[model samples]
Target: MLKPISTPTRELVNLDGVWRFAIDSRAGAEPWTGLLGTPLEAAVPASYNDLFVDPEIRDHVGWVYYQREVRVPRGWGGERVLLRFDAATHAAKVYVDDELAGEHVGGYLPFDVDITDRVAAGERFRLTVAVSGDLSNETIPPGKIEVGMNGKKKQTYFHDFYNYAGLARSVWLHSEPKTRIADVTVVTGFEGATGSVDWTVVTDGVDEARVRVSLSDAAGAPVATGQGASGSLTVPDVTLWQPGAAYLYELTVELLDEGDSVIDSYPVAVGVRTVEVRGHEFLINGEPFYFTGFGKHEDTAVRGKGHDDAYLVHDFQLMEWSGANSFRTSHYPYAEEVLDFADRHGIVVVDETAAVGLNMGVVGGMTGTPPFPTFSEQYAGAATQAAHAEHLRALITRDKNHASVVMWCIANEPASNEEGALEYFTPLVELARELDPTRPLTYAMVMFATFKNDRIIELFDVVSLNRYYGWYIATGDLATAETYLHGDIQGWIDRTGKPIMMTEYGADTQPGVHSVWDQAWTEEYQVDYLAMNHRVFDRFPQFIGEQVWNFADFATSNGIHRVEGNKKGVFTRDRKPKAAAWALRARWRGLEGRKPGSDGSTGAGSGEVTGADGADG
Candidate 1:
């Protein structure tokens, strides 16, 4: 869908703040007819799970209700009024007063509805959105609903992260003229400092409107202009967007009438760059690029998967301070605000779909000793595949314009070794490539999907592996872990001969816990674990990138396997640096062995690195 923006012919009003919220128990009908019963206030653009101290609210399964009041601006009488929900977890249904407006599935992506018919202009009416967290085999990121001992439904999934659901992003009231720009897609490239932008404009409701496109430099000076619905614009002496150094050009698309009067206008921030996989290197703008960062989650202290601008800025700042150049939105897509920041700051991103835990026997496989067939009729069958494809379509359409998004990860740790693995992923891979052919594609392969067992590794452009030798397998046996790691890498190299990247590899470490020897879950051990992995990575030319498992600790489902939450973060959930953070800073910044003082400050680095330069140190 076209993102709502304020233009001369369009208006956007942010409807984000406190709203009346209640947990749904299927107790009644016609919920849109009156005020919410026993409604408690909830902050929009945040997950409601951690906002309350009540355990029932935190663990409540199934659907929930969020109600707010909105007024159709009197001036919008002639325009199309729509309600845009940036995101609603899993599934949602919109009700304008007593009429159902629209319904949508998929949690991470945005959905909208035209409320024009339900509400009159200048009239104040109720806007209610019902959000559900329940999942089935037919949904993306599939899971099940189980009744607990208390006879209340609870969500069960294979992933480790908490299922913090609700309205986790901004909602907007927007309006546009009858004839407006519907969609805009742009592809950027550069050859010897001259950048080319191929642009397409899709218009709605207007058949005779003239199309005009223009490109402006960061200084707001016009550089190139064109007339047509689809064409290419070239800028001489153009600046390229690079890692740690971002440059943007504004692309403005406008619709005009026969009299040359402007009817609609929309601008997109364009970063002129190209991404490709060349042998053992990933290239951006014709230069060899390395991915060094983390697989991050949109999580915070109380937000719990919510998109917070403050945390967004801080997280990027911390990543920069640690010399990271890129990151993957690990298991799912993150907020668009985060991607916009990455484009502005020149941070590379490996954008992914919300297709986590699709595997049957390994990470999210059957609960029994034998894993159930993953691609069976009861699991991720045709319906699940369709959902997954639509998810990819929306993801690419929404994010394909960003320069920071260089690669698209189709899934994280799927059971690619299973029977239907190859058949299931073939079309999705084609769809991703067909939708956006400018960038490479990858999927984070679980450790179980080895070269011998994996059936779909050769289909992807790059080999992305999430190997946890020291943590899950060797467990403090680095000497033995090194052997296993080497074998795995060599096997992958011999199997594919394609460039490989480590999307995840880290040990859980508590901040204050220290150990001098090779141990797991200790600060010193975290440092050692990273060093060992890097040491092995440096020896292989096929290993082109290394994005650690996590940037910071995050909340997860309560279990004996976790203490408070996942401690694999180099930094704490509060953004405090652990010993591994310093080790990373040292190696990534070309300095190492710098110990922190008692005041939680980093000391001088040792200034010794072997894995080349720039993030690899």
Candidate 2:
């Protein structure tokens, strides 16, 4: 779907503020018919779980309601008005004045509802959105709900992240012309100094509405113009969008009527670039580019999974300060605002789907065995595969045109070692290639997926393995962990010729905890844990990157393994650096913020962090 933007023939209004909220006592209840009897005020664009003092509201297992009255602008009479939602967790059913308007499944994706016939100019109507946090084996991130002995329904999810619900992003009311540009696809490439942009425009109106497209440089000078729905535009001198330096060309598309009068005009800011995964190396613009970053989540204290600009800007600043150049959306698709910021700053991104916790075998990390098995009918069967496939399609369709996204991660730590792994994953891999072949595809593999047992690793261009050697495997024995980690990675080197990246590897360390001896959860131990992993990483030239398990500590489900939340982050949840952070800053800066690839020599003793000795934070 095309993102709603203000154009010459379009008007945009942000409908984000306090809204009347209530917990649903039963399913299929229409709260918009009358005022919700027990309505409480809640803020939009935030997860409702942590915004309340009551535990019932925080841990609710079912549906909730968010309603507000909106007025149609008087100037939007001739245009089509839309109810736009940037995101609604899991699923949302929107109603206009007590009548069902539109609905969408899958959170973290934008959708729109046409309300042109529901209200008139200068009139008011109740806009109600009923959102559900319910999940099942049929959902993207599968889960099971069971009623406890106390008769309260409890949700048991396989994923580690807390299930934050409600409108996690902004809501908007926008107006568009009768004939508007629906969507556009731009594939960019360059040869020598000249650049080529292969463009295609899709319209949603009368077939007779003519299309006109043009490209303009940074100074607003038109470089090329074409009169068609799809064609290629070439520039004499092209400035490529590099890893750290970015350049954008504004593409203006217009729809004209029979008399050559402009009816609708849409603007797109595009960056010309290309991405490829060469043998044992990931390349951008045909040059070897290393990735130095973390896997991130949209988490905060009170807001939960809410998307806030203040946190986003500060997080990027911290990443740059730490000498990081790339990041992954980890288990789910992040808000579009993040990618837009990346586009402007030229940050590499590994766009992932929310197909987390798909494996039913490893219930308690890598060693423990669960009673159930994955890729089966009772667990992640055909129904689960269908839902997972839907998310992949939606993810590519939404993020296909992004310049920052270099690859697609279909799943995180799936049970690719299971018996039916190949049968289950063969089609999904094909589907990803079918949707967008411009980028490579990979999935985060569990520790159980060995070279001998892994059935689906050969399908991917890059081998993205999430390993925990010192922390989860060896457990406080750094020397033994180093030998074990090296031997295990050597299996991959002997088996395949693919470029391998340690997508996740970290030890949970408390920020203030300090110890001279190497002790788990201490700041000093965290530093040593990272150093040992780096030693193993430098031994193999096929090891292309090392993105720590997390950018910052984040909230997770309550369990014996968690202390308040997951502490695997190098930075604290509040964005404070631990001792391990300094160790990474020193190493990555020395590597010029790129992972060691192609070079067999170990890079050490260079790019010192100077000030603090990294003994304590």
Candidate 3:
């Protein structure tokens, strides 16, 4: 399942415009035989939930059908044509010319079906896709869809985000040779002044084939070359991809015929570096790299969870402006373009899964409160674990080669203290390690999990904690919150001798509300909360990274707890800088020119932030 890298010989057609859309609310809709001509039109790579004004259409909790007509290029005959959908939420089924093509479970990953035979036989093809955003006890981000007192279905989950559904990414038709290179796995390291690249090329149609791997510098100069399906190459003078001074090498894999003529080639972008955890230190290229960034979500106005190029470029620029060197794909993996940008700009990413809000009934069992039914021990059985394992394989197979993805975060705030949590995560952790041992594995531990109850912490290479000492637990008391935060973090350090990363720590702040002093939901309060966390973070040498809860305000499900979505973002929803944004900019800027392995005594101080310029203030 190696991701396809575009080459000059490859043919690609993007299907990314308006398409006929309709909702199958009756749940009687079947692919390849049902309704044909729908009048309503929606963007192909957009969310159907947010496009409509009607409440029923906005909150429709059933199958969404998208139909379009595509003409396969006449030259694509004899070649393997792939009908690729970049992403479809929760579940998706594809049909071509009223024939079942493929069905895929789980979303946020790419899936494709071979249509070479059919495409060669037809001039025009009818393409249809049915997508479901439904979640249950059996799903990864487990939840329940129950009828409320008002006779309307309500979607309730442990996560604090909206369930946006549709073809959230791209759709395309790509042509490849019948016998081609299927995958390329790369592991890079340094040997003295030179760099080493060890790789394995997996091919289909033949057990053995002639493969040639060539390496080039950014300026298109040949550095090193090799000839084999699996071998190693040494570059004399390699440029290491460093923070602020990012560099990249171009890797080209060519598939040859028996006569040594090239049949197909894959152009890949790779960085020469290594990531490892040494004792309590997280190192990148043998340097103690401190991460200063946010736990970001792929969300914005109107688009909801849809991928947009404008927002994508804007976010990377803002991250650079804020002096951030890294960020985690908080709850799930983002679109492929986002990671490409991170690689180009030298931003480290802790790539995470969509496995958020997986807490079960165990937490409340100790107390008197009723536990969550969807995440109980009944749901964490063999079936659920198998589904999760498949998702991990798809994700790792898709993103294992990216230079920006420094670590792999298997889950976010899962119920590590639950009854079956250990049993469930044990195989998953082992599976991820078996898949890619080059990267470190971690899961964001919830505050509810203490030293005595939690067992999953010992399994991970790094310890990632999402603690809210002053916000959720201590209300608004930073004085008392400091003591609680210090003790909890120290206890974890004593328990596991691994590097600690604060994956989430922030206070929600409304846009306009201001207070001279610290008041809840005020701009000053967020600034104060961040300052306290920074002060405490400076005390520990084992603390390697500090990623805030959110990078910007995002849309979420309507609930009493959320005020116009999560306001924990340093920037507003429209990408405007709040007071806390300026505070962070100043703090991160001070650490800009410093070397990687430095002990910081430079604490952040108060600063005056300005108003929004071009956008509405």
Using TM-score as the measure, the top candidate is 2
- How accurate locally is residue 601 in candidate 1, as Cα lDDT from 0 to 100? 28
- Each candidate's root-mean-square deviation in Å? 6.3, 4.9, 5.3
Local distance difference test values of all predictions, in order: 0.83, 0.84, 0.80
Question: After superposing candidate 3, which stretches have Cα over 4 Å from the reference?
Answer: 26-31, 149-152, 361-377, 593-617
Candidate no. 1 TM-score = 0.94
Question: Ten consecutive residues with minimal summed lDDT in candidate 2?
Answer: 608-617
Question: Would you estimate the TM-scores of all the predictions?
Answer: 0.94, 0.95, 0.93
User: By lDDT, highest first, what's the ranking?
Assistant: 2, 1, 3
Between candidates 1 and 2, the one scoring higher on lDDT is 2
lDDT string, candidate 3, 318-391, tens digits: 99999889999978888988988888889999999888766653234324122553234455566667778888
Report the lDDT tens digits of candidate 1 across residue range 1-617.
78898888889889999998888763266578888875488899999999988887888887788998998888888888999988899899998888889999998999879877777788998988889887888888888888879887778786768888999999999997778888899998878878899998899866533889999999999999998888999999999888888999999998998788888889999998888888867778776676789989888988898899999999999999998889999778998999999999999999999998786665332221225688888788999999999999999999999989999999987878788999999999999989988889999887667777789987898998887767777789987677777777777777787888899898888889876787678888888888888877766766778888789998888878689888889999999999888888877776222211113222221211111000000
By lDDT, the best candidate is 2
lDDT of 2 by residue, 353-386 (tens): 9988877666644443546778888888999999
